[model samples]
Target: MNDQPILLILMIAVGLYTFNLWREDCKNAQAGKPSPSALPGATPASAKACIIAALGALVILIAETWGELRLGLSDQQSKITVLFGIYTLIAAFIEELIFRGFIVIENKGRALRWAGVAMASVLFAALHPFLWKWEDGVFAWTFSAKGWFSTAAVFASSLWFYTVRFASFNPHRSLLPCIVAHATKNMGVILIKGAQGFVVGLF
Candidate 1:
């Protein structure tokens, strides 16, 4: 069974859910309640936070994928890099909005907040196939070393994103920093992978 269709369907579902969250935020704003926008505008401080978060993500990615850094893409893979880049940016924004903006924001109280973060981080990690691959009929009970490492890395990254989003200076809890940081991380991965592909092609 081709997983691409399942993945595409999952992406659409996530996109719709994110859109609903944005709509709710708009409604809450109109009612004079505190709510974060899914696509909030970035302030200078948020921009700085974004840079910090992106750099942090890059460090984590580099550490996690160090051995695979030299792996290259095929000609077909190179051709799809642009499309993947766009998908990464949009997907990162939606994931951040859902996990940090909606999930974390909705759960009130310190205990609930931590619980929310933990649950969201786990869900975020699960969404990445690198961490847990689905086999012929089900997800594998056993993970490769890479899968375990990726899961840990993704969980940590999700926590980092939540921290940045929640710590925004904006009174309305803007998620711009999270979005920017996530996009930057995705772009960095794409660029690095593309460079690797070019180098391999030269040899």
Candidate 2:
């Protein structure tokens, strides 16, 4: 089954949503009520923070890739395309906005913030559909150890993303570092997929 069309449509929708988020941020900034904890933060992104967050995510990704390989799970084999790669990059920002920005409850204390991160991470991991898949209008449940491992990794990555946002390095709680970290993890996946000859074409 070719899912290219569906992917394209979803990408367009997601792009629009991202644009809207940016616009809202702009408006907030102009109103002198900048949402430092949200998208389009008023403060400039720190290059050092970007590097630290990206490296942190990259480390997690490497471990996940290794585990998948050891488990003989080639999930991306013959499944990726250039279009998908592009979508992944766009989706990285979108996901970060949703999971790390909007979903997170702000102005909370340290414990509450970490609790929110934990809850968001769980939801993020569950949304990845590793233990189940919807196909042909039917939702099927099929569990694999590899799938579980991947889900766990995603959960861990989400924690890292939230940590990056709340960490002292991101004093203003800017989303830039989170975005970079997410992108690094996603691009790493694309690179690994391509290296394994899983990326077929542009689609």
Candidate 3:
């Protein structure tokens, strides 16, 4: 256990969240629709959504990995990256499928989907050790007031955008947006950190 306690715990939290969502996915599949692995053919609307999501992800990755803000492979840093990456990918897929796809479908109205997003955004903040970096993170956990303002900022902004993006298109099509937002958020953080380091190096 050479890793940081907070980071480790957060990783576990993400795992639990993802696992719970995966189980729900299994239940959804039992009904009729296919799972993420065997998702049916993409409709024209969904295909477009996917392309937009892919492009956004690409832009974020490029900004981080290519710019002066690139990350280093220090032991602790690498560990955090690997754990976060794995969790992010898993959580994004699971969370999106449940919150956006399944819940929206089962609820029969906007109420359920809105509730899901609210719940997801709140939970998403809790799962973060550095919640202060998002938007609503401040309201999620009070004991740790560290960077709470910043975290809240990101959460609100991201959620606002996420809601709008999801509303503009169908879940079958908007799944990509959620996936992209998750990936892009990770990449965006990395880029900011990288840029900071680059600036520091020049000082």
Using lDDT, give the best candidate's number. 2
TM-score of 2: 0.85
Model 3: per-residue lDDT, tens digit, 10-121? Answer: 7658667755655555456556664666332112235556556655555544543443223332211222343444455555555555544454433357787667667766
Candidate 1 Cα errors over 4 Å, as ranges: 1-45, 67-81, 105-107, 134-142, 168-171, 198-203
* Candidate 1 TM-score versus the reference: 0.65
Off by over 4 Å in 2: 9-42, 75-78
Error of 3 at 102 (Å): 5.7
Residue runs of model 3 more than 4 Å from their true location after superposition: 1-47, 51-91, 94-105, 131-146, 157-165, 171-174, 198-203
Count backbone overlaps in model 3: 13
Please give the RMSD to the true structure for each candidate, in Å. 6.4, 3.2, 9.2
Please give, for residues 118-163, the per-residue lDDT of candidate 1 as tens digits. Answer: 8889989988876444666686655565556666778888987877
**Every model's TM-score:** 0.65, 0.85, 0.47
lDDT of each: 0.63, 0.80, 0.49
Query: Which candidate has the top score in TM-score?
Result: 2
Which window of ten consecutive residues has the lowest lDDT sum in model 2? 36-45
